[model samples]
Target: MLPALSEKELDRLEDLLITYGNDYSVLNLAELNGFFTALASSPNRVNPEQWLPAVAGGKVPKFKKPAHEEAYTALMLRYASQVAEELADDPEHFEPLFEQSEGEEGPTIILEEWCFGYMRGTQVAEWSELPPEQDRLLKAISLHGLEDNFELLDSMSFDEHQACVPLVVEAAQGLYQYQKQHRH
Candidate 1:
């Protein structure tokens, strides 16, 4: 019942975070609004298995091999930086992305809808068999105030993970959204 952000919107927000150091109010608003999760689920209506791998590659750096996980993180950060730089210069484009309140002091309909949609979609995914570690990371990304603990990911507090936390998060979101859309 909640409105959702398209995949493109999440990508834009992520880019904003990468450039603005994740401290910007707009970035926080976007995450709090559940833009990323909504975006993840958007493509699933079209294809399930195929879309998972693709968006996973874009959102999280590591999905499969552990050895290359660092490279994946670097790539994600680099992409985020590029996106941030692009977004910073374009006030017209970026302002709307941040514009949840009307007339500068009204209710934030888009943000509220985005949050609701994200929660619904994520809950649906959690009921299924998605990886726990990955789900945690994705939740961090989708929700404001959640941090990505690189230290925890780098070390093995639990079973030795083949994929880094971010990678798993990305892959799980992909799989969850895919399954949600394609399920019979």
Candidate 2:
């Protein structure tokens, strides 16, 4: 099994992603986590080559050095592998790496970026229509992830948004289990 990313390596990876510049739609760390989680839990295996380009928007970034490119790819692969192993070993304990910020009430868990990443994963995986129950699970994620849901989310109270966190987590775990059970 690949070792989990250390804090230092995560910081380095984040820096590398930023270097890709605004021209590309590179995902931030939180979004990458969500993206990898979705792919890892997918019912069908998605080749790394197929999904790697999606990491940097739609095209692979040109690295300054071959070593840099290799390192960047390694970091991403290890991180993705770690996410998969965590879910496979203990789905009940798997957690999305949502960002948190201090709020008037308490720490506010930011779900938008992560949810967006997960949605992207589904798209890249070309997920087909699922059963109603499974679709409901995905909806829990899209509620916060998709841009169209922003207005609805804006209308919700802080507490209401907070309440959705568990639902999203439950949705992720449920999806993983569903894929495991239904894998072709």
**Model 1 C-alpha lDDT per residue in residues 1-184, reported as the tens digit of each score:** 1223346654654553444332222234343234334433432332323322333422333235564454434433343333333333441233212224443434432322333334443543343444675456445434422234445534542323322333333543454445445554
On a 0 to 100 scale, what is the lDDT of residue 99 in model 2? 78
RMSD values for the candidates in order, in angstroms, are 18.7, 1.3
lDDT of 2 by residue, 28-95 (tens): 88888889888987878898898889988887789999988988899988988998999999998899
- Model 1 deviation from native, Cα RMSD in Å: 18.7
Which window of 10 residues has the lowest lDDT sum in candidate 2?
Answer: 19-28
Candidate 2: residue pairs that collide: none
Question: Could you tell me every candidate's TM-score relative to the true structure?
Answer: 0.23, 0.95
Q: TM-score winner among the candidates? A: 2
What lDDT would each prediction earn against the true structure? 0.38, 0.87
